[model samples]
Target chain A: MAADKVDPIHQFHITKILPINVGHYDVSFTNSSLFMAMTVIAATAFLILATSGRSMVPNRWQLVAEMSYSFVANTLRDAAGKAGMKFFPMVFSLFMFVLVANLLGMIPYFFTITSHIIVTFCLAMLVISTVVIYGIWKHGFHFFGLFVPSGVPAALVPLVTMIEVISFLSRPISLSVRLFANMLAGHITLKVFAGFVVTLSAAGVAGMAGAVLPLAMAVALTALEFLVAFLQAYVFTVLTCMYLNDAIHPGH
Target chain B: MASNVNTTAEVHHGGAEHGGAFPPFDSSTFASQILWLAITFGLFYVLMSKVVLPRIGGILEARHDKIAKDLEEANRLKADSEAAGAAYEKSLAEARKKAQAIASETRSVLNAALDAKRHEAESSLSTKIAAAETAIAGIKAKALAEVDGIAIETAETLVSTLAGESVGRDEVAAAVAAVTAK
Candidate 1:
């Protein structure tokens, strides 16, 4: 381990597992894909099997499943109202996927799926696209009213609407960037701190004592990272709900 | 640390340089990542909406309804027990009243019988007292009449023997009557 620098960025690197060339596009099954698959299976299995008992009095696993269910349900209801519940599956899927992936990434050496901007972009796009499609479909041309807020002065209408449009367009970018950045920064910081401990402790007795600081920081950061993991998921879901709200009642 | 990171990045990238695109921002991996995300997230969505979510919702709803039903049943039972308790109290009160009535009736009946017996005994005692008084009166009158007669006979006999002459019967009678009267 001497002179070997801990590469914080290495963990996020996507390596081809089973390469699949799809007509000049390399959509190879990578470690990222494996983890996604794992996330899907894990989330599905846990949610399904835990509630298999369907007991009137829920056990621990069932209780967690129910709590998460109601948590998302409440979030969706609060943000978008009952009409937004039609997109519950999509919102819930993204939340579970992000949450599970983030937690899985907490394991040492695990590739974080959410750390990638493209993945979060796709999820953000999914939410935005749903808002667009459903908004247009449900309310027709009236959905465009979302950009025009009520009670604005007639002179500022154009300016306010343009700002609204730009803001609306930036939703996907910000949504993706926020989650990606949080996870990316957290994981990298943890790795760098851990690397410091390793590099320092190998130096000397004094270096080992100095390593304790980073070590403690690493432990504290790990706890914070876990919180960030759940928080990001919640934020993502909440934002998704809010975006879906635009679709349900665009005038508001 | 900087040299080491650069050195490894160089070696790892086949000398693709130190400032090459970070893996997260890498465009080459986007296609693969997007494809897989769609596949996995789509699968998860389908599984949740189709199977898992509804199942969990059903469980929660069932538990909710079951709890409500149990509560309602408990309330009903409570009311039922209260009704039975009220009925018990009512009967207890009725029985107490009936028992008091029966006791009073029995006491009154016994009292009537005792009064009748007392009255019969008093009347019989009064008749016996009257008979004793009448017998005493008869004795007393006979004694009194004998005393008067004895006094008159003795007086007449004294007068006759002293005067050496027998007294007339009518005069003796008249003399006895006057002495008795006085």
Candidate 2:
């Protein structure tokens, strides 16, 4: 195995430059940052083109655009209730951005930010932070009471509250891990099978004949991964909506 | 063929065991992950809100308008059909009434024609009866005159034969008067 391939953790690398050091943090942009910027620009251009003309009766492109809106809108309404409307734009933007990113990652040689755990973790952290801030802002200090269930006996309050707080704190870790693991696993699976096709073809005639099954499997898995990509984005958005619901209506 | 060969290679080598790609978590990997997460989140936010949601809403509203217009058109057609049905019924009834009036008129005309024919036939029959009565009266008068001449001849022959001699008219007249008296 090559030196680069032998290093287990070295697969994920971050290069830092001493361009201009901020007071506390290293805010230098990297390849990942560049792709993130590209994703945003691409997303903006896509929407602008889709809704260039505001027709009463939408064209095929506009129809697709509207369906995406209603799907997210209804999802938020169902999961988060009337208060969800306040965060509709946020949740909508989140779904669209993730969906595009995941789809873009499927393209050859495109950098899939979602495949990285740090990317997923950061998003989860944002949601968790928003939940905490919104909860405290809406309920004041009483937001701490969220960990204590209503109608519970005083004797169990401490234990119950500890459990609730642990669960709440674990949100970012679990959310990030779920998405990162799925994206990473799916892509790696495709690559390994792809690698087999090359290696087998290079071998004898028998190896070439044997490559057909894995190639077929890889094709099927790729299609499935596409579905998974869409589903994960949806699940992430729904979870965000549910968490926002907690902030909107605490105590339960 | 190559795809098949690749399958055996991946299976034999344990494709899932590509463990080098993902290893234990470390500080650098963690930081990179967070940075990517922030970037992706921001990108998604703008795309959905600005582009996707509005387009979806427009489609839904347009569909709703289409459905509503279709229903309105259906209602109008139903009303028109009902009106047409009523008009058809009215016209049918008027035709039936006109048919009945024509039938009654025809019956009256036929009856009047029959009465006039009966009256003409009766007048012609009465005129023929009157003409026959006049002819009979004329024949009866001629026959009475002839009978009077033959009765005188026969009486004369009978009186001569009975008296065996020529008898005068006064004697015959007296005999006829006696017989009449008796």
Candidate 3:
């Protein structure tokens, strides 16, 4: 097999289209940046244009836009309550970015932005920082109360507090890793199964006949990857809402 | 087609020049990814907050207000129709009552005129009958007196003719009267 055909990691390569160094940082415009820009632009255009008519009885695209709005709105509201509605813009942006980025990645030869740990980590940190800043800002020192469970026996307070602190601190890592790993692993698995088909079919008639199994498996995995794409985006956003809930309520 | 991108994540692209550093784990890409994430996400947040949300929310609120106004208008029209229907029913009942009163009054007036005519006709007929009865009584008395005189004359003439002798009118009258009396 050719070297390019052997490397699934090649899909994730951030080829620099333009180099733009800011101070000491290598903040070049890469393929990753390209897809991120596309995701936002596409999302923005769809939302803005879909509602342009402001039709009482919405058309098909308008309905989709409205449903997306209400869907994320309800997700945030359910997790964080009415007060959480204040973070709607931030939460909604994250959801749209992740969802669009993941689905865009499903296209052949397209870059999956969320597949990178740095990207997902930053998105997760956006959520975590918002939670910490808003929680502490709103509740002052009382936000620390989120670490202490009210119903726990006094004997286990120290132990439980330690566990809560670890869990609380691990939120960004877990959240980021969950989405990044799912996208990276799913795409890799699909590529492997699909590669088996190509490698086997290249051999001979007997090997060509054996190629159908992996080919069929690849087809099913593609379908499953599409689901994973959407699911990971949702998981990331929903976890974001839950973390934001800690900011609004702050009490266990 | 993405399935054809090869398997084995173990095979890192040697061309990337970052050596064995995995693309995701590569810290060199982090700066750009973070920078782009901020820019794109910031733009999205601004667009959503400034334009899209307000427009959609306005459309919804306007629809809600319109629906409420329409319902209030419908209720007012219903109440007006009911009032009109009640007035129609009341006037119809009054007209029916007036018609009944007029009919009764006309019948009473007709009956009174008819009774007066009947009473005058009956009284005039009774007076004429009483006058006819008195005249008939007078005629009957005169006839009876004439019949008595004729009977005395005939008796005198028959006696004279049989005896062939003259007699006094006074004596003949006395004899005839005595026979008639007997």
Candidate maximizing TM-score: 1
**Regions of model 1 farther than 4 Å from truth:** A1-5, B1-6, B14-19, B131-135, B146-182
Docking quality of model 3: it rates as acceptable
lDDT of 3 at B62: 76
Best by DockQ: 1
TM-score (all chains, Cα) for each model: 0.88, 0.72, 0.74
Total clashing pairs in model 2: 23
lDDT of 3 by residue, B1-182 (tens): 34443333333345453775778999988999999989988887898788777766677677668888999999999999999999999999999999999999999999999998998898888888888888777877787777667766776677778877767777887887887789
lDDT for predicted candidate 3 compared with the true structure: 0.85
> lDDT winner among the candidates?
1
Name the docking class for model 1: medium
Candidate 3 residue lDDT tens string, A110-137: 9999999999998898889999999999
Q: What's model 3's lDDT at A111?
A: 93
TM-score of chain B of each: 0.73, 0.60, 0.64
